[model samples]
Each structure stands twice: as structure tokens, then as C-alpha cells.
Target chain A: MAINKIVASVEEAVADVHDGAVILVGGFGNIWNAPSYLLTAISKLPVKNLTVVSNSGGFGIEIWGGVFGVHEHDVEVLHRTKQCTKHIVSAPTNPLVVNTLETRYRAGEVEVEMCAQGTLAERVRAGRAGLGGILTPTGVGIPEIQRDKPVIEIDDRKYLVEKAIKGDFALIRAHKADRWGNLVYKGTSRTFNATMAGAARVTIAEVDEIVELGELDPEAIVTPGIYVNRVVLRQ
Target chain B: MTEKFRIDDQTMALRVAKEFKDGDVVNLGIGVPTLASNFIPGDREVIFHAENGVLGYGNICTAGEGSYDLLNAGGQPVEPRPGMSILDHAESFCVIRGGWLDWTVLGGLQVSEKGDLANWMVPEKKIGTIGGAMDLAFGAKKVIVVMPHNTKNGGYKIVKECTYPITGFRCVDLVVTDIAVIEVTPEGMVLKEVAPTWTPEEVQQLTEPRLIIAPDLHEIELA
Candidate 1:
């Protein structure tokens, strides 16, 4: 069967994003990371009220990396750049995300949802499946009030039945994708991208290489074409 | 069981620390439980375990001592006392999982009259999780809860049935709150004492699910 997926440019893929949209951006720190080109599009888009879900805005060579004191320019712009009000950070709490989201939250620009590190990953899984909520007992009643909301009860035992979370779009960076939209994430980049694919309504993948459909092995496909909505190539 | 009184969080922590005889391994859950370490009296040979791969932790460290990767369950930088050993996450989990913890001090959002606990997660919070609270609750030889007697809204944390999620059922052995110190017995939450500032009736009113106070219960004083 001919692949229904077509390769589009980066901008064309994310152009439809509107203000106050929730977007899941997958990647961790200065290791195998997501494509900056996509993040650039996100930043350039300036979509307000965005809930940016990510592991880390890594420093170093990472699009989110900056060694504690690496810059020589008396003025800083990278970490200093503030996200717009519409950006909401929904993911595990980490230093990088804290710094990024803190700037926004403290500025009263965005909202933060701190999910347990493991639970945060599972949330994408739950979100994509369209489940009511996943029961894991991540938070029963740690705080009386968390961020001005009550952690309500469900069954006899307390569990934070996190509502199934879905996103407006996902900006995924994979190592390669076949023209059919079958894709594979190389090493660490696979971190949250594969899971994000399941949860996002519209997934925009920026692949390093795009090959013919059958050129890739069937077993190698981490994300099936059915889940994928669009594909684009970096080079 | 030994009984004592405390005027505030610091006093409560100190009074609980006095219960340690010697050479006991303990795990302190996040928040209020973390304070117990600071209140421990002079050298009595106590070791602390952290769920995130740390053992024999010291009190919260001051800056300029040395930069350390050691952290409590809350992920905040903590000072590992004089003789501390660092292990991997899984091994540390084993310490808790193996029931090696002699005692554990935990904070509770709500404690039912049945001794059920709800402290790890709250509603609508993306707190990211109930870290190691369950493990410590079930694994420790003695589970001690330290919290306020009543919530700010005047609702009792001690209830007939937990309105929040249950961390462990009939697992808590002792509950030490700002109001009074009580123990869980088959008969129910046996009221050990009433806070010095309040009367038994006041404590009873603050508590839902009527409490079973010990007959000889007298007000407790901190050591």
C-alpha cells in the first residue's frame, strides 16, 4: 500500500497552531535532543497560552542547555528569554523545566503541573489511549491544597486519577521516518516522543532522514502510521 | 508505648526523637518528617534512609560547607551527617522495601479513626507524585504520623473513613499532631492526651468520627 503520509516543511506543519494551545515538546538535556528548528518555529509562532510539555530545555549544545557559567557576553538572552503567558508547562519537575517555567509562573505568565517523574511519562500513555484516568496512587494527599486545587477522592483508596490528557499538537524529533509516516527514534531522543505521539491530536515530526515506506523494516517502526498525522524532513 | 507532649512542630519533632533508644535505622518521609532529624538530641547513634538512594543523612546543610548531590525524598539538597553511605536508587528502595526501616515519621493530610493515611497526593495537583510515602508507610516497623489536629477549615483530619485517598489501611501505629498525641488501637484512636491549650471536648469537637480517649489520659508535657 502506498504511504498516505506526505513530507511537509517545518513551518507548514506547525502553522495551524493558535493561541492558548497545549503542545508537547519531547526531549531532555544536552544529549540526543529534539530539533531546534521545530522549537524555533514554536518560539516564532508566539502562540499564547501554550502548555509546553517537555523533559528539559537542556543547556550546553542542547537547544535548552547552557553550562552554569558558559557565556562571556555580559548580557544573556537564551535562559533569559521568557515564554509567553499562553505557555503552560505540564510534565515532571526538573531544574531546566523549573527555570523555564518558573520564569513564566513567577511572572504570572503560565501554569505548572508537577507530575511525578515516572507518572508524567505514563500520563502521555494514558492521554493517547483516551482513558478516563490512570490509577497509580501517585498523589493521595501530600498537600491539603496543591496550587489552589483539591486532590479529590475516587475509590475507597485515595489515588490521583489524573484526567486523560491530550494536546493540541506535538512537535516530535525522530532520527528517521519512512515516507509512510512509520518512524524510529534513535537512542535517547525516543524518550518522550514515542509516547507523545499517542497523546497528541496533531503530531508534527521533524526527522533527520525520510526514506521510502518499504525501505524501513516493519519491525523497526516504533510509531505506526495510523497514529502519525504528518511528517517533515530536516535535511 | 512512650507518651510525650509538644508545643509546636519543633517540640513535637524533638519529643519524638527522644523515643529512639539507640542504634535504630529510621526513614523520615518528606515535609514534617524531615524535621525530626534536626530535633534529635545528642549523639545517640541513629541512621536515616532516603528513598532516592541515600543513607545515614544529616540535617539540612548550610551553604559553603561543600556542594553535595545528596538530597532527601523531596529532592532538596540535604546534608548527609558524619558517617553516611550513598547507595543507588534501587538499593535505597530495597532498604525501604526490605522492611529495614526501624521507624518512620510521616506527615498526613488525613488520618482516619481506623488509622488509614492519605498524604502523598491531593486532588487536581500535578505534584508529580506520592514519592516513597507508601513504601515507608507499609515497610517501617512503626509508622508515626505528625500533623495538625484539624485542617484550617476546622475539619478533623482524624475521621471514621478517609475522605481523601488511603495510603495504607490500619497501618499507622502512632499519630502525633499539633493538638494531641494519639495511638491507634483495636478499640480505635485512643486519645493519649489533649493539647495543653485545649480541652478534651475541644479536641473531640475538632475530630470527626468520635475519638476513644484513654480513661487515664492526662495532658502530656514535652521533655
Candidate 2:
């Protein structure tokens, strides 16, 4: 694993991604988000039908680029969209995540999976912790959501299966990163970045500014060096 | 000084809304509480906070003025004010935790005699999570509840004890309902004023529990 964290641009960072691979993108409604430059890159490239791992299905599709179609077309929108959906899987209850579903799901083009935000946090935690699958009592019933249908019996108590989320490519936004590839965020930016890095096979970050490796505080650095494959500077 | 202080659900919602004051940071919980923002005097600044992480929420967005990407916690297209700020989810919680909120107007299933609030969760249903209702109930300096006086079948909502899960400790300060305005104190839901055409005895009779009467109740100032 040649962990050369610094790359020239987001395009070079995500150039390896081919069409049809699932990519986990970081950001909430385009704020403190993974570098969109890659999306800009893929927009022109041959890649299509991208499976994006994100809080919502939002991108230029909802605004700016008229690609709000992606918000409708995401096969697995991690949050609820306006597409009018039901909880098929355990989903995040966080309002922001739910709003995404309310908007895109009602459009009837996307499928929304409802998972707990804490569960998403924990699952990503498991990926970082190097575990196969972690179990919990998050989503049990309402009977409509049918993931892990087998009612696994644990001491007469029933539990549902929550599968781990692993992505082929991890995209993240960092406030600062060094040329050697250490990253930092201005505030509570660590919410999804660390877990996203762990869950993805090739993690790519688009940082506001790139610096040297030792330029960052060893303690302040959230995602460690092992998980990050490459870092690219954002415009 | 005998002017009747009666306001139905809508007026109660709009009139008590005067307390928001200009430029005051306010968080409107779901439902009727959400309507209070509409009543807020718009000429001056009254910033609204929706826990889903949008600050400086604006009123009725015109067509084409709304951003598909910009949304309220409820996921509706809302006009971002001139001074709007977007925040991350966890950081939004921090603003609530840091006591940055001025007032939180919440809608409740019930307001107990002790001012306890039961707004966020419904036991056994398992539908929605208690997003920052608990935080706002206790975090905001002032907690105001706006609700209907009676249920559909004419049952009262102001009760002796909450028969539901609670979002915060005994923390509700003022309640503006269709029938009356009540203040939640340690002494229980003391009747602060009577709605027009309704007597204290009539209001008490309609209530499930005997709400306490303040020694000196008066009419709403009607802001």
C-alpha cells in the first residue's frame, strides 16, 4: 500500500474508480463535504450508475448542476428522500438524513433505507475496529422493513441483522491536509470522515489546504495514516 | 380592566408569539409550535433554529427563490435569510448544549400539572427519535408550549400527571392554549388567565385534573 496521501487533484485521486463501483461520499447537503471535483471529474468521465455511500442522495442534482436526478436515482439512499418510501433497513433518525428521504423518496425514483445514526456510527466503528459484523437491537419491527428476516434468537429475545457498510471508494472533505497526507477539520468534522475512511477500500480525501506530514498535531489528526490511501487538494 | 383574554388555537399561537422579540434566536419544535414562527413580527429579525442543523430559517419561500439543496430540518425548501449559517449535525447539538438558544416553542402531547413536557417520543410506537426536543426543553432559557385546549372528543390536554414518556425534567415555563394561558410552576399548572366567554370554573370542569388558580390571574396583554 503506497500511502502517498498527496495527489495533484481530486480527479487524479479518484481516477482509478471505474463505472458501476459503489462510492461512499462524505458531506451533508453539500457542506463540509467530500471533494465534489471527483464528481465533476466523473461527470465528464465514462463512469455512470455510481453507487454512492452518503448521508443522502443529494449532489448537484438537487441544486447547482440540475443533476438533482441523482437524488431520485440512488439505488440505496442511506437516508429518506422525497421519493415517498418506508423504512426498508435500519436508517438514521437524524433529521437531516430523514429530510433527504422525504424529498427524494417521494419522487418515487429512489429507495430509502432507514438506519439509526448511532447504528451507522457504530457500524463504521466496527469497520474501523476490524470486525466482520456487529449486532445490536436498533430496528426490530414495524413488520414492513424486512432486512435480516431470520428472527435470530438470543436468550428468548429477538434481534435483526445490521450489515456492515463497506465502499469501494471513500471521499471526504478535510479542512487541512499536508502534502504527506495528515488531515484535520475545523470543528465537529470528524462525524463521518473517520468511519468512512475505514469502511471504504480506497479512501480519498479532498482537503481545503495541503501541508507537510508533521505540520499537523499528532493528537488532533482524526483519521490515522493506515486508512487513508491518498489525499488531494480542493479548489 | 375586564377585557376578556380569549384566543382560539390560531390566535393563541399568533399572539403569544410576540414574546420572541427581534433578533432573538428561537427554536420551534414540530407542529403548532412551528406556526409561531409565522406569527413572529417579520419586520425585525427573529432567527429560527431547526435542530436538523439550519440556522437563520426564513418564512414562505417564493417559487424559484428556494434552493432545492437548502432545506429545513423537516426537509422543505426554506428561504435562507441574509445571515443564514449552515452547521453540521453534531455541531448543531453543541449550539443547543452551549445554551445558545433563547426560546424553544414546543408542541406537546401533554403538559403535566408540574410543567413536565411529553413531546418527543411516543412509547411502544417506535417511529421517530427524540432529536433535540429533550435538549431544547431544558437548554433554552424559556420553554413555551402551544397546543389545543382539548382533544378531538373534548378531553383536556392540561393534566395532573403525564401518562406518557417525558422529554425533559419539569421545565415548561408558559403554555398558550386555545382555551387559556397557564404557567407551569412547582405548585402545578396554575391558571394564569381565562379565555374569553369561559369561566375559571368552566375551564377547571373541562380539565381532567383540577388546575391550580393563580392568586392574581389577568388577561393576555395581546402583543
| Most lDDT-accurate candidate | 1
Error of 1 at A74 (Å): 23
The reply for model 2, stretches above 4 Å from the true place, is A1-235, B1-10, B62-65, B124-127, B215-222
Top TM-score model: 2
Binned by DockQ into CAPRI classes (incorrect, acceptable, medium, high), candidate 1 is incorrect
In model 1, which regions exceed 4 Å deviation? A1-235, B1-6, B62-66, B75-77, B124-128
- lDDT of candidate 1 over B1-223, digit per residue (tens): 1133437877778756766667889888767777777766666778977654567877766644523245565434576577886543234545765678888888898898778888754544433334466656656788899897777666778888887755666778888887777889888888886677667777777778777878888876566
Question: Where is the poorest 10-residue window by lDDT in model 1 chain B?
Answer: B122-131
lDDT of 2 by residue, A1-235 (tens): 6446687776777788875676766554344343466555545455554555555434233433242332322222233222122332222233333345434544454454544443444455566567765554434442333255555669875555656777777777677876555667643344455456656888888777877668889977766766777887765
Fnat values, one per model, are 0.05, 0.03
